[model samples]
Target: MQIEVLNSQASDINTIFQFYDMAVEHQKKVFNKHWQGFSKALIETEIAEHRQYKILVDDKVACIFAVTFNDKLIWGDRDKDSVYIHRIVTHPNYRGYSFVKEIIKWGKLFAPMNGIKFIRMDTWADNDKLLEYYTSCGFSFAGTVTMEQTEGLPKHYEGISLNLFEIEVNEVAASM
Candidate 1:
């Protein structure tokens, strides 16, 4: 298996968007249908920072993930060198291999070199399967997001609360 960390660019962005769409369709059992596009501004903001775009490949694209501190509202803010994982998605065809787990492990190991010592991520509360998967992958449930759904997003109105998870890279590594 080949795991690579990529950056957001015209070619890779298109590929990542397509991968996300496919993953949502394939994992509809967990992903909400309303998962929408990140505003152009949001994408650009991250792009301007040149945030690390993490990808896992096993002959083909298996997963896509990006870690940055700005994903703070859902994931939280940590001190300098801290990071939050965003958009971690696994291709439908490679779901059984536990690709997301590998993505998380890769992030933990790669973070320190990038000045990131902690990593955080979030998921919907209803997605028990993913929650367990992250926990099994060494993430501990930090808290639940109880805020009222935002006006624009259908998920908040759909009555699904999100569960937040966090993992300290050193802690995760130590346990391993």
Candidate 2:
């Protein structure tokens, strides 16, 4: 019932990694290419930086994600007023809960409080199902871009076209 930043507790490390493995396993079954998974230290850094987050349902982490203020590698310094969403992984037992739609709704209320104008995210350009799903969830597809630089990006993003999605704050407010 709540979305909050994950704290850097040692116990959290195992749970997060477990979730990542579950996601990777699912991805392997469903997609030709998938996330290469992140290192525990990378997650530790996100936790320490307050970028990692979880959606708690009944006091348990049902879904997890990370957000960043800037993603110049994938986004190319396009929008300063954006919160870039990343690494959205759902707990296997929590599937079918529509957690992404929940995150989308939460972003509407949460983004503006921090002076953000856009709720932005990107996925592999080839992930058609995801593109359709995100579109159905209220994101506008902003076309795809092949990253020009990839050194600082995650492994999956090193040399691929990425589909961009964004929900402008004004648009959400207008609809509501």
Candidate 3:
């Protein structure tokens, strides 16, 4: 398996949406609340910004995710040397393969390559499965935060308490 940046010029946008929609349905079943599906324009912007990425297995996109150097909206005022991970969606065909582990392994390397010292991710505070899964990946449970302002963030962030996870770059890389 290989991880690569998403190429806007060559990638299929609809395929990305299909994955998101599928993930939404799956999340609904697992967590009872699904992510608010993103807009095509938002995705296009992410692609143009080179923040989207894909993991390929046998020439097929197995999973997709996005990253940002700073998530001021979520992490607000935290001065941590970290890269923020968001929206990890795995193709239904690729389920049961533990893509989060793969993403974490990849993120362990990817963060340092970009000169970052920490890897951070956040999700709904009530999502215990996700918090546990990330902790198993070596992320430390930082705590829960109910952001006072989430004006420009995704709909899910509106009036929500998010669980924070942080993995020191060295911690993840050493284990890997």
Best by TM-score: 2
Which residue pairs clash in candidate 3? Answer: none
TM-score of each: 0.75, 0.90, 0.89
- Give one digit per residue, the lDDT tens place, for model 3 in 40-153: 888888888887778777768888888778888778778468888889888888787787777677778777777778788998898888888889877899888997898767
On a 0 to 1 TM-score scale, where does candidate 1 land against the true structure? 0.75
Higher-ranked by lDDT: 1 or 3:
3
lDDT score, candidate 3, position 45: 83
lDDT string for model 2 (16-129, tens) is 888888988999999988788788788888888878778787778888888899987777758688888888889888888888888877777778778889889999899999
- Which pairs of residues collide in candidate 2? none
Deviation of model 1 at 63, angstroms: 1.5
Per-residue lDDT for 1-176 in model 1, tens only? 66665666644666677876776666666465446555555555566677636455744666776666644445434434667776777776666777667666666776776767667777778788779988988788987875454543324324556787777777547345
lDDT of 1: 0.65
Minimum summed lDDT over a 10-residue window in model 3 is located at 1-10
| Candidate 2, poorest ten consecutive residues by summed lDDT | 1-10
lDDT agreement of model 3 with the native: 0.79
